[model samples]
Target: MFRNREEAAEQIAARLEHHRGSNPLVLAIPRGGVPMGQVIADRLEGELDIVLVHKIGAPGNPEFAIGSVDETGHVELNPGVERYGISPDYIDSEAERQLENIRKRRQRYRRPPTRAEGRVAILVDDGIATGATLFAAIRSLRAQNPSRLVVGVGVAPPDTVERIRREVDELVCLEAPAEFMAVGQFFQDFRQVEDEEVIAALGGESS
Candidate 1:
């Protein structure tokens, strides 16, 4: 999308100049976010890291996230949990199942993903869906008491962007396509970001 990832990163990088003086640490949500965060960090001359999380899929449909779980296994459920009259026990059970995936991802991605303690922490993802994952990551990062929390992405729906803005201290979204379907839709090269590639990028193994 937009020629390649560079173009999207540069566009998002422009919004991060204010933090350039202090050099915020970029935390890319693994997979699609690694490349994007690597570019932003390069442009701003900041350190790059990775934030790992897993979606808490709905019971029947694993692809649909009813919530999300972070590296530490903290779960945040959707409003539907209450609105749809789902039980807390059910939510807890689903969260536990997702936590296993989060643990595996963290082990595979980074032996120990660094915490953003008292640092300017930027949360980067290729994009946001219902924002369940982003929200969980933000909540987890808040516990570290980062000096700043920024949500950066290539694109998202306008309403989702607004929701993210409310949760994060700032938002650096490039495009909020009105008819947005999936994050891959806006990308010309929406190829799957392999786990090894994500590690190479965030770990600086890739040149």
Candidate 2:
């Protein structure tokens, strides 16, 4: 397992060095991804920003994501969503609710949204689990017409890696173990990342 998020970021940074002079925008999924994003921004000399995505949980099993919604109101449903027997009404209401939360988060963050029009967009998360949030985030980024879209993560399931790889221009993931169960399982210190930490990390150029 990796020592911590720092070590993971440093390693990912090495793989991302080619973007250093290209001015890629590193958008992180807070609150766990902020630290990793900060390290990437420092190493690549890129600007740091946030991409807030809220998971649309399955009915009765809130931890299990049926889909996700990004800050821009773009929703991504899992291909297996219908098998879960979730109704369209529930998905609509849940998406609206999560969008409101994203609204509040952006307001609380108080940072002007980054312009993704002509630059490469790199979305970073601590890791991927169901891949719902990252999928939504990638779709949203794609809508902005970025020159390119990339995904960087510390670890993920092999299936998830393959699924996301097709969606982005580049995928820089450190590990995709066959026996993976959760993102935290690959980290030596996988603690809860708080909102305060996210805010502080964004306030600085790097962490």
Candidate 3:
């Protein structure tokens, strides 16, 4: 188990030692991944930035992600999202709602996103559960035509790991236990990351 996000970041940075000095771009899924992204970016001598993507929660159960929408309004639905019996209209509404949130975050964070074109880009997150949001992030980054894309997370279930592996060129996952329940269960200090922390990680003053 990780002592905290810092320890986990150090381990992940070690695993990615080969990327040191490569000037890779580290794009973090905000609110949780920002701290780790800062560490990794410093360790690898790369730039740190945020990738905005919000989960499209299932109807009546906001914690359950039906899919996700990225900053560019690109919606990626899960393979079995139709099983939820959600209408197309509902999906459209949810996507727009998420896009608004992404916009607000972009403004609040106040950090200009770095382009990934022709560069090695790495996406970092605290952990992964269903991976709906991360998948959307991957697709969004792919559109930028990064020369190489990598994903680094503290922990994820084996199933999610395999699915993510298929999406990225390299995936650095610390733990992939077969009996995973939640990402927090693997961390001793899985506290909620505050917006101020994210802003500071990006060297922006909180508004």
Best model number under TM-score: 3
Question: What would the TM-score be for candidate 3 when compared with the true structure?
Answer: 0.97
Please provide, for model 1 over 119-187, each residue's C-alpha lDDT reduced to its tens digit, 9 standing for 90 to 100: 899888888878888888899899898999998898889998888888888888988989988887787
Q: Can you give the lDDT of residue 96 in candidate 2? A: 94
**Per-model TM-score on C-alpha atoms:** 0.91, 0.95, 0.97
Which candidate achieves the best lDDT against the true structure? 3
> Whole-model lDDT, candidate 1?
0.81
Candidate 1: residue 23 lDDT (0-100): 77
- Per-residue C-alpha lDDT of model 3 across residues 67-130, encoded as one tens digit per residue: 9999889999988888779999989998999899999889888887789999999999999999
Total backbone collisions for each predicted model: 3, 0, 0
Superposition error at 33 for model 3 (Å): 0.7
Instruction: State the weakest 10-residue window (summed lDDT) of model 1.
Output: 198-207
Per-residue error at 191 for model 3, in Å?
A: 1.8
Candidate order by decreasing TM-score: 3, 2, 1
